[model samples]
Target chain A: MHPVAVVNANGASPIVFVCEHASNNIPNMYHELGLNAADKISHAAYDPGALGVLRCLVNEFDAVGVYGTVSRLIYDCNRPPEAASAMPAKSEKIIVPANANITPAERDARTNAVYVPFTNTLADIIAQKGGQGIVITIHSFTPTYFDEPRHVEIGVIHDDDPTLASACVTELQGDGSFVCEINEPYSREDGVAHTLNLHGTKNGLQNAMIEVRNDLIATPDDEMKMGIYLAQQLRKTFKSLGIDLNEVSA
Target chain B: MHPVAVVNANGASPIVFVCEHASNNIPNMYHELGLNAADKISHAAYDPGALGVLRCLVNEFDAVGVYGTVSRLIYDCNRPPEAASAMPAKSEKIIVPANANITPAERDARTNAVYVPFTNTLADIIAQKGGQGIVITIHSFTPTYFDEPRHVEIGVIHDDDPTLASACVTELQGDGSFVCEINEPYSREDGVAHTLNLHGTKNGLQNAMIEVRNDLIATPDDEMKMGIYLAQQLRKTFKSLGIDLNEVSA
Candidate 1:
C-alpha cells in the first residue's frame, strides 16, 4: 500500500509538493505525554499549521501533496529507518514515553506499519505522475534547537536535483524581504537526504525539501502568505530557466 | 537500534553463515488467524527446519550464525519496503487478520520497527566482518503454488551478484541427487531479492538466497544432511572459483 497522499488532478502543472513532516499527531492510543489539550495542540503535536500551506499550494498550483499522519517523534517519515533520528530518542526535550527502551518486537511493528507505507506512498505518487513532475517538500523547523539559534530564513535541501533548489535559493536571495540558503543553514550531506535518496535519487526524480522557519508559518495567515510567495517564486524561477511547468501532464 | 541474533563459536573455526528467513513468528499482538499452535509452529511461522540446517552448517564449517527474530509473515525482512510481498496480504492462503485494512499509522509502525531494524542488523554484521566473509541466506519453499508443481529440487536467487549463486547452482547440478535451477524456480524479478537487493546490490556484496524444497528439509536428519551437502558443495565451489571465505574479518 502507498503511504503518500495523492491529489488525483489531471493537470499540466509540473510541480508536486510533499510535506513529510507536515503533521506531528501522536496516535490516540499514545496519550498526550501527560500534558493538557492546549499543550498537545502546540508545535509538539503537529507542524503548527503547515498543512494550511500545503492546502493553499494545491489550490493555487496544479499539484499533489503527500504527507504523514503520525508524528515524527513516533517514526520520522523524512528519515530512513536506519537513521538515528528516524525513531528519535527524544523530541522537544520531552521524553517520548512509548519510545523509551523499545523492544525488537515493538521496533518491527513500527517499521512494518509506518515507515514502509510512508515511503511507498511517495514512490507510488511519483510513479503515478509518470516520473516527469518535479517534487518540492514543504516543512517548518523550530527557530532554535536546544540552545542553538538558527540563522537562515529559508533552507532548501536537495540531493540530485540541485538545479531547482539552486534556482529557488537564488530567487529568494535576490529578494530583499528574505534570506535564503542553498543546502545551508542546513544541508543534505548531514543525512537529511534520507527521503530524497530513496525516492528521488534511486528513481532519478527532481526533488527538494524546503524548510521555512516555523515562526514564519505559525498561523493560517502566515502559511497562506508563504504558500503564495513560494508558489510564485518557484514558478517564476522555472519559467526563467525555459522549463515549462505547464508542459507536465497528469 | 539493530536487530541481530548472534551465535558465537566455542571452537576454532573462522566462518559465519546467515539465514534470512530463519524465523517467521508474527507477534502475539497479531494473533494467529484461527490457526492452532501447531500451525503457527509450521513453515508459516518459521522456515521449515531452517534453524536445524543452519546449526549443522555452523558445526560443519565452524562458524557463526546471525538471524532475525520475528517471522517474515509480519514483514518479510528479505524484501524492500516497496515490494508487494514485503508485507503480504495473505500468508499460505490464510488471510492475515491484523494486516487487513491497515491504516497509514499502522503501516509506518511496521516499516520503522520491523523491516528497517532487521536489515540494519544484517548490515552491521557484514560491516563487522570487514567484507571478507561469505553471506548465504537459507530458505525453504513449498513444492507447489496454487496447483502448479515445481520441478527443480533446488533454486538459487541472485540480483546482479550471480557469481556466488551461479557457482552454487553448478555444483548442485553436478550432484546427481538434485536437479538444480539457476535463478529459478524463481528469478530475482520474482520479488525474492529483498536481502540481496539492499545488502548485496546496494552495498556491493556477494550473496545468494538458497531455496531447498520444504519437504527436503522438514526433518532433522534431512536438514542435517542437506546442510552438510550444501556446505561441502559451497566449499568446493568457492575453491574452484578461488574465493576465500575466511579472508573476511573485522
Candidate 2:
C-alpha cells in the first residue's frame, strides 16, 4: 500500500496543505502494531477528522493536499527518523508491542517506507509553487487528553516563524467566534511543529498548522465549516502580508 | 565562565554572526572531558579559527557576533540536545571516553551549561533585529576528515532555504578567486544546518553557513583575508537580492 495519498496534485493555487495523521490503517505486516480493536480507531491511531478538513481547504482554494495514509503508530511522518517518538513504544496509555525494542533494521525499514515518501511528495508539490507557496498543515486534537480538558477550538501553531500564525490568530480574534489561540494544544516544544518547521519555516514560506478540536470536526459538515472559516482567515492573512494568490510567476 | 561571547553586541548592522564551534576549552568541571593535551587542541575538540573569522566578519560589517566559548566536545552548540552528536561519544575516529554512556543528568547538565546559554543569547539578539536580521554562521572545517582528502576550500551551506546560499555562490563564482561549493563537505543531511535551520530560516531571515577550510584560515592574517573576501561576496549577494544594508528599518 502507498504510504501517502496526494489530492489536487495539479491545483493552480499557491497554497499547499499537509495532513500527516490522516489515516489509521496499520498494514498486515505489523498486525495492527498489536493494538486492540478499540485502541485501533482511537485518536492515538490518527487525528480524527484532519484529512476531511484538509480536503475541504484543498477544494476551497484549489490547493494541493498531501496526506499520510498509514497509522502514526507505525511510523509518525511528522517526526524525524532520529526521534524515538517516531516509532513509539507507547503513546499516552497504549503500549505498542510491535514498536517496543524494535531493531535498527526494522526502524529503518518503517522510516523508509512511511516518512521518506510522504516527505518527498509534499516537498515536490511545494517546490513547484516556488516562492509563492504558503504551507498550511491540518490536524485535529482530542477535546480531552489524559482526562484533562482543552479549551482551544482552533490552534494556529507556528515554530520560529510566526507570520502566518500571528495573522490567523488576529483574524480569528477579530471574528470573535472561535476559541482561537497561538501555539495552543501543542507547540514546537511538544515536538508537534516538526512538520511545520521542516516543510514551512525552513523553506522561507509563510506557514501555519491549524489544529481544530476533534470534537469540533467530528462530522463531514463540521469539517467543511471549519475549513471554510480557516480559508477566510488565511485569505486575510495573505492580504496583510502583501501576497496575491492569483499572481503568476514570470 | 560565560558559555558564549558576544562581540559588537550593540552593533546597528542588520546581519548577525554565529560561531558555535569556536573554542576548545573543556572547562575544569569534567576534567577536560577526558582528553589529552594534543587531542584537546585538535579539530575534534572544536572548529579551529572559526571565532577569528567570525570576529573579522563582525568588524568588517559592524555586525553583532555571538560565539560559544566552550569546546564543542563538551557540548556542540550547533546541534540540538536530542542529537547524539551534541555530546558525542566519538568524533571522527577519536573516542571520547567521558561522553560514552553518560547519565541523562550529566547530559542535561552539559546542555544547560553550554548549549542552552549559547542558544538563548543568539535567539535574543536575533529577536531584537525585528525581522531585518540576516544570520550568517561561520566555521572552519578540517582540510581532511578521517583518512579522506577534501578539495573544497569554502562551503556556502544552507538547509531548506537556499536563497542566500545560491546568491553567495553565484557571486563567488563571478569573482573567480576561491574554491567555493554549495553544501559540499557537509550538508543538511550531515546535521550541519541545525543552527541555521533553528535561528535563521525559521525566523524568515535570509541565512547561510559559511564553511572555510581550516588550512585557509589557520592564522590571524588568513582569517581576516577570508572574512573580508566573504564580506564582499555577501554584499554583492544582498545587492542582487535588492537588500540595502545601509537602510534603517522603520
Report how far off residue B104 is in candidate 1 (Å): 55
The lDDT of model 2 is 0.85
Off by over 4 Å in 1: A1-4, A7-12, A32-39, A42-45, B1-250
What does each candidate score in C-alpha RMSD?
A: 21.5, 25.2
lDDT of 2 at B171: 96
Off by over 4 Å in 2: A1-250, B248-250
Task: Tell me the interface RMSD of every candidate, in Å.
Answer: 25.2, 26.7
Candidate 1 lDDT, B54-79, residue by residue in tens: 86687677677766666666677777
Angstrom error of the Cα, residue B109, model 1: value is: 55
DockQ of each: 0.01, 0.01
> Alpha carbon lDDT of residue A219, candidate 2?
42
DockQ versus reference, model 2: 0.01
- Model 2 clash pairs are none
Each candidate's TM vs. the true structure?
0.47, 0.50
